[model samples]
Structures are given as C-alpha cells and as structure tokens.
Target: MTAVVSLVEHAPARAFPLPDTVGRALAASKILEEAAPDSYERGMWRLRAGSKVGVVAVAVPGGETVTVRITPKVPVARLFFLLGYSSDPAGWRDGMVDVAEHSELLPALAHAVERQTDRALRRGLLQGYRTVEEASLVVRGRIREAEQIRRRFGMPLPAEVAYDEFTTDIAENRILRAAVDRLLILPGVPQTVRTRLMRQRARLADITPLVRGQVIPAWRPTRLNTRYHQALHLAQVVLDGASAENLPGGLRMDGFLFDMNRVYEDFVCAALREALRPYGGRSALQAKDVHLDECDSVRLRPDFVWYADSGTPRIVADAKYKAGKRRGYPNEDLYQMLAYCTAFGLPEGHLVYAKGSAPHTSHRVRRAGTVLHQHALDLDRQPEALLAEIRELTRRMVAGVKGRI
Candidate 1:
C-alpha cells in the first residue's frame, strides 16, 4: 500500500500541544542547513519563551539570505511588529505605524490588525447575522447619542466617556429614551433571551425604569457577555447608519476580530496539511465535530483524518487550546482517532500541539497495543522554507507509517 503523510497546523495554537509544534519547527530548522546552498536562502526558528519570543536563523550557504520580510503565516513576528516590538526596522510597516499606540490597547491587537489589513474583506460574511438584532440596538443607541446626548451633554464627550454612555444606552435604552423623537420608546423586547430583564420589566408597569433602575443596576455587569453583546449591538448601529459597500467590510472586520485569532495552531495545521496534500492526502478534514459516544470503550471524532492511496490512517491531527498533552487526549480525540487508526489498524497515531516555550518535541504513549506519536509543531520560518520542510516531514511521516524509514 502507498503512504499518505499529513500535517495539521494548530488553528487555536494554545489548545493543542505547543511543544510539539515547536519541536517540529526546530526539527525543520535543523534541516535548514541542508537546504540547497541557495535554493532556499533564508531559514530560521522562532520559538515561544514565556512573555517574549526566541528567534534564531541561520545564514544559507551564501551571504545574507534575506534582510527581513514580514509574513502573515508567522504570528510571532507579526505580534511583535504590531506591538512596536520587532527587533529589526524593516519589519515595521504603515499599518503597524498607523496603529502603533493603539495596537497595544487590544488584547489580541496583532491578530486584529492582520485581519483589518491583510485578511479578505469578506472573510466573515455571516458573522453579523449571529447578533444582528443586538448589534442594531447597540449601534442605534450610539447613533442616537452622537446625534442626541453627546451634544446634549455640551461638547462631544471623550471617546472613553462616550463608550460608557453607549453601554448604558444599549442596556437600558428602552427605559431611558421614552420620548425619542416622539416615537414613543415603548418598553419592548429585551434584545436577548439570556436576560431576565424582561421579567423585571414585566413587574414595572408604572413609570418604567430607565436611568435609575435598569441602567444603574447594569453599572457593574458581572461577566464579559454584556460587553461583548454591547459591542455586537454597536456594530449593527454602525451598519445601519453607514453606506452600503463599507457595511459588509465593517461587519467582516468585526467578526474576524471576534473570531479569527492567529495562534501557533493555525500555523502548525497550515504546515502539516500543506505537507500532506501532494502525497495523496487531505490536510484539513473539517470532518463534523466529533461527539463522544461513551457507549462501551471510547469512540472519537477527528477534525482531520488522512489516508494514503493504500487506504490507511496516516496522520490524526487535532489543535488544542492549551500547551502539553492532557490526561487522555480529551477522550473524544483519543477514541475518534483510535477508531480512525484501528478501523484500518494503521501503524501509528500522531497528535500535534501548538508550539510553545517549553522547548521539547512530543512524547510517545503506548495504549491499546499501538504507538501514538505526539509531537510539537513550530511556525517560525520563511513561507517557502516552511513549505519545503513540511514536504520533507510528510515524507518522513509516510515512510515511518510504512515501516520504510
């Protein structure tokens, strides 16, 4: 039977095994020395080390392979550059400069900046649809305040102050703006089902609690949900008040900002799958989310399952949010891939982690009379160089599965 080798990059890098990806990245770095003298000039390895990053690159056989280049695939450099933390000058760009001070404000500012500047404009077409109504309420409040209250408070309030007022508006708008343009702001739907606000509103049939009762009570909202909801709500307001073409773009950016985060997993999975495809395999098998059936032993669902021309499980890849291997591969992962490997009784199973600061590759655990190979996959290299290493790793994985290497 032919061999089908596959690599899966860690999408949510932290969820998977970080060390494994780092190991793979480092493993590839070791082979960089062998890259054709000048075939691929620039080669390097950037591993995670706590708060900061550790980047080390080797000059190809020739001089100065690459001065410096920024890549979307490499999250570490982008994160550093976005935060005005790049070690070199060339890595800095207009957007990074444009967002320099503000970049440090957002928690995942680097990823957000990338999405705003580099990612597709329509990348998240349906995201706004998820909270369309809530978005409408939030934005509506802001538009109203910018038109109404901000000026009513004398001068335009500081953006920070406006932000707080906007929160107050969305959470308690139904009560606050009673005579909004003679529209009679009748008490209506609470905008979401999670809230028991409606039950509270049901009791207050008299004057209706706007500023004092509802809005004031919401002052110290507990979880981040209210904030997220307000953000979503504000988004819709902007959508409605804004022009048509930019509406879609704005929605996509907001959604991408909320959902798509650049982590080591995204990097690792990209490399892994890229390696496997050319050799008769599929990299990402968005196979339906596996639901663990705890009937007898354990059954699993794998995000991606690959096979060579010979119909054998070549690689079982999953992305974890945390570093290191957990107790039992999250039960579902174990059983799903076990069924994948055992169904065909393949030789090995591989679990890839998002590369982290730890520094070692992965471990081999023996279970059910089979060898499960867990490894760290890294994501610190030139795009082309990284792809080449993926190809080689694919070859090695396939050969190992076939007992040929």
Candidate 2:
C-alpha cells in the first residue's frame, strides 16, 4: 500500500545528509566510519565538500545563494545499492567475474537510456511496450550468446589449443563472430565491455575440464565448476535464431518506443520499453531531429506513457538521469515535460529522476492549471520496490487528473 501524497503539500522538516537507504545499509553493514558525519541538518543540509574542487560558498536567504557541497565518500555497499546487483551474494561475487563491459552509444545517447532501461527492466519484461513491433533484440541475443561462450571459455586458450585451432573455431562460426559484432552495435550495448567480454570468452574456453588436450567445454557440456564452468545459457538461446528471418526482431523492438508514444499520444516519448511494465503501461523514445529549427524547438522525449486499465486516461513521464537540487526542478526538464503534457492533451505529466542523491525530494508543479509531478526513482532501492513506486505513482496521477477535470 502506498501513502497518497498531494501535489499541494510540501515537507518543512529540513532534510538529512544521507539517503534513508544508505543510512540503514551503513548500520546493517556495521562498519565504523573513518570519521564523523561531515554533514548535519542545517537550514539546508550542508557539507563542506564536491563537484568543483576549490572551496566556494556564502549562504544568504534566497535559493540564489547556491553553496558548493561535498559528496560523501561512497561506502562499499552503496555501489551495489545503485547498480541493482547483489551486494552480498555471499560467494557469488567470487564466482561472478566482473566482466569489463561498455555501452556503444555516445555519452548523451547512453545516459538517455540509463533511466529508460532502469525503468523498463524494473517494471518487468515488456509491460511497458506499446506494441510487439520489431526489435533488434535478435542482434542483442546473438552477440550475447557468442560473448557468453567466451566468458565461459576465454581467449589465449591455456596453451592447450594453438592460435590456429582457435581461429578455426571463431571462423567457422562455432562462436559466431558476425552476431557478436551486431550485438555490439545495439543502440545501448557498450562497445568496450563487449570487446573485453568477447576476448576473454574466446581465449578461456579451449582447455578446461576435458581430455588430455580435448577441453570438455569444446562441446560445452553442462557443469558446475566456477574454476572451469561457463555462462553460456543466455548466449545459447541467442544463437538458436540468427538468420535473415530473424532480422525482423530489431524492427519490433525499435518500434516499441514509437508504439508507446502513440498509445497515449505522448510527446517524443523516449523510453527503453522495459521500464514502463510495472505500471501496466508502455514507453517510447522520441526526437525532434527531423526539422532543423528544432535547435530552439524542444525535442521532448518522454520515458513512460500510461493508458488507464479501462482505457480512459493517459499519462506521460520522462525519466531524468540526475537528481535535483533543493531549491527547485530543472527548468529545461519542466519545460520539456510541459510540452509533452500539452501536446498529448494530458492534464498532468511527470519527470522521474534517479534517486541516489543525499536526499531525495519529489516536486509537484502546477502547469496550465493542472498538477505536473516530478518523481525520484531511488537507484538505491530494490528492483521490485522501485517498480511498485512507479506503479502507484501512475495510478495516483491518473486519478488525480480525473479529479482535477
């Protein structure tokens, strides 16, 4: 059950130096801090540290007096807290090799996706997709498969198989190189990580628990030896269908963003499709790059769009990658979402931001005589918990809009 929050209300309790989750984790981890809390609650939560190096500040009454604040040193558990991975997997970390990975998009493009993927994956498989159009998922699947083999196997084959034998395996598509390359090209797959994962997989697979020199994984039998086992399950499914016939996959996935946008008539709704699922909604990614005057023209791309279960109301939300400062919301963001809500004929809209900042705050704005909300998704939260938060917010927003009308 969720506590209903009114856009009209505000919290006057000042704030704290730490996020509640981080504060709790610190206590649970039970590690003594090297020092005391640099930050205590002042009129504004103050810390004498971050962003730009040199000391800079003076605080007065207005929000105009911005102070340079310090970012606290990240505790060990906090890293896992943000990435949605298991922090204390017990021995799993030892078994789970930290595969050096990278995304293939330019920084701006990739960051745009961070929140999109975060939302969709959290929401559930495809609950966020507007339609089952085509997707380049086949490409992703194919590459993931080859890479898994390499992770399981590895390159520079244990002096057991010579370079010639390895080349033959890769050339014959035993590991499938073309699919690997295509996977790397996915709009969001990181290239550098793909490179390292691929190299490691190829070099390591040839001499594990097999014969006098016949590496057992050569045939890749199922086994349970971290010292010798491989993570090929997902990759294998990918390889199962990698033909011209499968090329239709990317189109469906690619169009998913579009369907979500149309379903609710939201603006350039730029979503990863996965993040919208938990809310029983769909998402899309949009752009105004089509026209040149678009420089001044706002290319407002939203992340998630919702159509009511009874199909009466629709909502649009754009997920922001960064947290906001205490004073107010990012004007550019508010402007963009405003455009989305206006274009979609929606009375309300949302701007959802990642929530790993010192203190997370939700800002509810009144735009065009309707309430527009900015939500903060806690990066430190468990995946299921985050999904629930988004779901409840959607339900409330729809109902709120109806009440306003």
- Those runs of model 2 whose alpha carbons end farther than 4 Å from true positions after fitting are 1-281, 287-299, 307-313, 356-367, 401-405
**Candidate 1 per-residue C-alpha lDDT over 1-405 given as tens digits, one digit per residue, 9 for 90 to 100:** 111111112222111122222234323433111212122223222322221121122222222211111113345334333223212122323333222233221213322322232221122111110111222223332334444444446443332122222222233233212212111111111223113223222322333333421222132223433323322222222122121111111111010111113233444455566567667755545444333444434445565566666654566665543434444334454554556566545656665544444432333346566655554445455444544655665676777766832
**To one decimal, what is the Cα RMSD in angstroms of model 2 from the true structure?**
20.3
Model 1 misplaced regions, further than 4 Å? 1-267, 289-299, 310-312, 325-340, 357-368, 379-389
Cα deviation of 362 in candidate 2 (Å)? 7.0
Candidate 2 accuracy as TM-score? 0.35
- Tell me how far the alpha carbon of residue 363 in candidate 1 is from the true structure, in angstroms, after superposition: 5.5
State residue 11's C-alpha deviation in candidate 1, in Å.
20
The 0-to-1 C-alpha lDDT of every candidate, in the order given, reads: 0.34, 0.35
How far is 235's C-alpha from truth in model 1 (Å)?
13
